[model samples]
Target: MNHQDHQDHQAVGASVDRVAKQVIDAGLKVHRALGPGLLESAYEHCLAHELGLRGLPVRRQVPMPVTYDGMELDAGYRLDLVVINFNARLFRDGVRRFAL
Candidate 1:
């Protein structure tokens, strides 16, 4: 990657971190209000909607693109959520990978 690309990646990473913090905060609110009685899927869906309402850009079910034999192969590896800012300066690539 060139310098410009590196800068872009850095900017994207910052935006991702910011949005990720917001998502975490929203998730905490949900956990507090709803507790652990509900199923994980239900909570996940609700949190996704809630994050969208907060003016955050979210992409769901994004495929993980891989390069194989000089060809781009989109595997079924999907990201549960991707957060990005309007300027594309900051971005969080995926959330599901971090879920424990």
Candidate 2:
């Protein structure tokens, strides 16, 4: 890649890293406040709220589309939480999936 392209990629990576950190921090805050034993949905809602309070746009239960045989289809797969712009997917099991 050219110098400009490299710089752009670095910038995007930095942004993703920042957002990921924020999401992680927010999730921790939620967990610490609520503790364990609650349903996954409870944690998902709380985390989304916490992230929103942190100024991150969050969408819950986002449908994920898949490509099958060159066709885009809704496979009933849903993301627990999607932090907009950064496209960070947060689940209750502390497993993070990013579509950056």
Candidate 3:
């Protein structure tokens, strides 16, 4: 990549890192407030709200499309929460994945 492209990539990476940290911190706050034993949906809702309060745009129950035999289709797969601008997805099991 050219120098400009490399710089752009770095900027995006930094943004992602910031968002990831915020997400993790928000999650910890939620867990500490609510503790364990609640349904996953309850945690998902609380975490999304926490992230939103932190100024991140969050989408819940986002459809995840898949490619099968050269065809893209909605296979009923859904992401628990997605931080739209940051391209970060949080799964039901408390895993975070970035599409960078």
Candidate 4:
């Protein structure tokens, strides 16, 4: 591979790492501020607010519909938060993203 191509790949990887750290920091901040014993919605809302305060756009309760053979069964599988700049959608169940 060319040197320039390697450098570009390294830069992109670094950027992704930085974004991941930022997201984790934001989540920690939310946990610290709110503490425990709260519902998922509460945490989701706080995380969204925290990310927004950091000048990042956050999407909450995003509809995730499921489609079957010629039919659709959307059992209300909503994404808890879709934080921008990280290329991922953090769910109450787990973190989900496409080909990071």
lDDT of 2 by residue, 11-57 (tens): 87787788899988898899999999999999999999899899998
- Candidate 3 lDDT, tens digit per residue, 1-100? 9999999889987877888989889988999999999999999999999999999989999887787898879989997887855433533333446542
Error of 1 at 93 (Å): 7.7
Q: Which 10 consecutive residues of model 1 have the lowest summed lDDT?
A: 88-97
Off by over 4 Å in 1: 1-17, 37-39, 85-100
The residue pairs that clash in candidate 1, if any, are: 11-89, 12-91, 15-90, 15-91, 16-90, 16-91, 16-92
lDDT on C-alpha atoms for all candidate structures: 0.72, 0.81, 0.82, 0.75
What is the per-residue lDDT of model 1 for residues 17-44, given as tens digits with 9 covering 90 to 100?
A: 7776888888888788789989877877
Off-target runs (Cα >4 Å) in candidate 4 are: 1-9, 67-73, 85-100
TM-score against native, each model: 0.59, 0.81, 0.82, 0.67
Please provide, for model 4 over 22-86, each residue's C-alpha lDDT reduced to its tens digit, 9 standing for 90 to 100.
77888889999899999988989888888888877788888877778977689889867776534
Q: Judged by TM-score relative to the true structure, which candidate is superior, 3 or 4? A: 3
Of models 1 and 3, which has the larger TM-score?
Answer: 3
